[model samples]
Target: MKTLYETSLKESLAIQKRVIGALLMREIITRYGRNNLGFLWLFVEPLMLTLLIVFLWKFLRADRISSLNIVAFILTGYPMAMMWRNASNRAIGAISANVSLLYHRNVRVLDTIISRTLLEVAGATIAQIAIMAVLIAIRWVDVPNDIFYMLLAWLLMALFAFGLGLIICSIAFKFDAFGKIWSTLSFILLPLSGAFFFVSSLPIQAQKYVLWIPMIHGTEMFRHGYFGSSVITMENPWYLLLCDLVLLFVGLAMVAGFSKGVEAR
Candidate 1:
């Protein structure tokens, strides 16, 4: 009986892997189209945006926002911020848009959300790496001082984005109005994410309040990893981790409940 149970579990896992792969391919084709840049757009799109931002900053001759490398600073910060925003935004109508897929016994609503979120996160990550490599090659930026910590912060940022995506996607599925509401909220979240400034640069009183934002911590940590002691930032990895856990728990619960309702219909 135990052997049979194990076999069934393995089969289920294999089937989920296949489902996710197929969905990813379908998403690429649908979103990017079959011709003209194709999958290259995944990285190129964000790369173009980042380059534009970097150019604007340089053109303005904006004095160092902090004691960090300007090119490296924006490169790390903006891409991470964009990743979270894009992931959550893409997840908004994921389940609703793919409702037909749920008719299959193996395809679940959560799978749709996961596949979409993964695509956004993967695209943003690749773009970030590509941009950084070019900047380093051109001597515009130096290699990260602590690559591992930089990666850990990035992972946390992705986790926060995925959790938020699950929550937003579930809520949007339940209420049409949520889509509009979240659109406005995403704008509000932009400056608050600490993508353009260091948390330590804020007034002491404001610093306390800003620390409440989880994305701020992730960005600060990423900067800290790259800039080392050259810049000061307020980052608490433990707090960020705790918030991510809570968000994930609530998000998954909401999504699972919503999925059951969709299945019943």
Candidate 2:
């Protein structure tokens, strides 16, 4: 009897793995099928955007860029924010994009959403790493003293991104125009993300305000790793960690609340 139960359990595990694997492969291939560059564009999109910003800013600042020497600041800030943006935004449309696939008994909602998230996250991380490498090689940016903290910082960023993604994915299922709302809100939120400038560069009160935004903390933490200096004066590692946890739970709650209805659809 125990052997039979064990066999059953193994079969179930194998089934789940097969489902997830198929979904992951389908999601990746589906993305690349549209374009010749395929996966290359994933890296190119963010890389070009970051480089364009750097070039324009450098030009606009002219000699002043070297004075402040904030290339590392931009590199750190932009990629961290972009990671969250890409992951969550892709997630927002994940259900809508792949709703047909959900009809297949083997293609579970979790598998579908996760496949999308993994593609976006993989693309975002690679883009960030490539840009950082180029900047460092060109002497346009400085290196981080602590690899461990940078990894921790990045891991936290991914958690926050995934949390936000889950929440958005939940909403995208039930609402008709959630995508539009998400886009508009993100436009408004971009200025506050601290991507273009350091939080410390803001006025004292503004500094306090920006620190309250959890996304800003991710940037600050990553910048700290890179520069060996803190970006925001109000550095609370614990607070940031707490914020990530809250967002993640909130996301999970939203998913749990809406998952039944979603499956019903």
Candidate 3:
């Protein structure tokens, strides 16, 4: 027989799971509609973006920095970055967009943000797997040397993205202007994320500074798995894990503080 506290906790968890699932379905239909591609666009959107970047880099980047396959390099790096970037970006205005739903006692601001972030992460993950499969089939890219490591890296990045979305969603709720400019600020920060370049490629002094950015660590760890012993990488899984924990703590606190004032008009 479960204690009353345990029973209540279990019921809360079940309700939250159901609420998030419903929010996810609503988001998919609202964003994509029931037209042609519809919910397929969840993966297709990221898939197309990754393909365009891969092709553009393959053709236009006249200089070859490494002997590694360019397609493989970008494929491994960009989609992972996109997972976090797009997730955090969509988190802006999440409360406002789904404010009406919050009128329901069980629906919450966190649920809205989580649903959006999860959708972006899911889309990017699916796109990365599908593209890797197609490229491997055609011999355009080699099989990853350590797939488990890649999965771990991807999972860490997704957690980081979720935490980031929560923080960004909290901030955006408080400041409408900040929400508007985050896209631009995030764009400026994207290159520094190590999406397009290897951390080992930087000067020894620069590498230390670049590694301070949490996103770079995930990118490096991911590429490390894909390239194996062929390349050098600098990624401290503990450091990124620490950042994820801090972000989640601060984000949840902020959300709890602000959500009270967010009445549905």
Candidate 3: Cα lDDT at 73: 76
**lDDT of residue 89 for candidate 1:** 91
The candidate that achieves the highest TM-score relative to the unseen native structure: 3
Best-first order by lDDT: 3, 1, 2
Minimum summed lDDT over a 10-residue window in model 3 is located at 60-69
What pairs collide in candidate 3? none
lDDT of 1 at 201: 79
Q: Lowest-scoring 10 consecutive residues by lDDT in candidate 1?
A: 62-71
Ranking by TM-score: 3, 1, 2
Which sections of candidate 3 miss by over 4 Å? 35-65
Kindly report which residue stretches of model 1 are placed more than 4 angstroms away from their true locations once superposed. 35-49, 64-67, 263-265
lDDT of 2 by residue, 70-173 (tens): 66666677777777787878887676667777777766666666777777777778877887788789888777766677778888888888888888888877
lDDT of 3 by residue, 1-265 (tens): 8999999999999999999999999888888876757657656665676678767766877438546687787788777877888899999968878999988999988889989999888888887888789889999889899999999999999999999999888888778888778888888988888999998888998988988899999999999998998998989999999999999999999989988888876
lDDT of 1 by residue, 2-54 (tens): 79889999999999999999889888888877575866776676667667776
Candidate 3 clash figure, as a count: 0
Q: Can you tell me which runs of candidate 2 are displaced by over 4 Å?
A: 1-16, 103-106, 230-233, 263-265
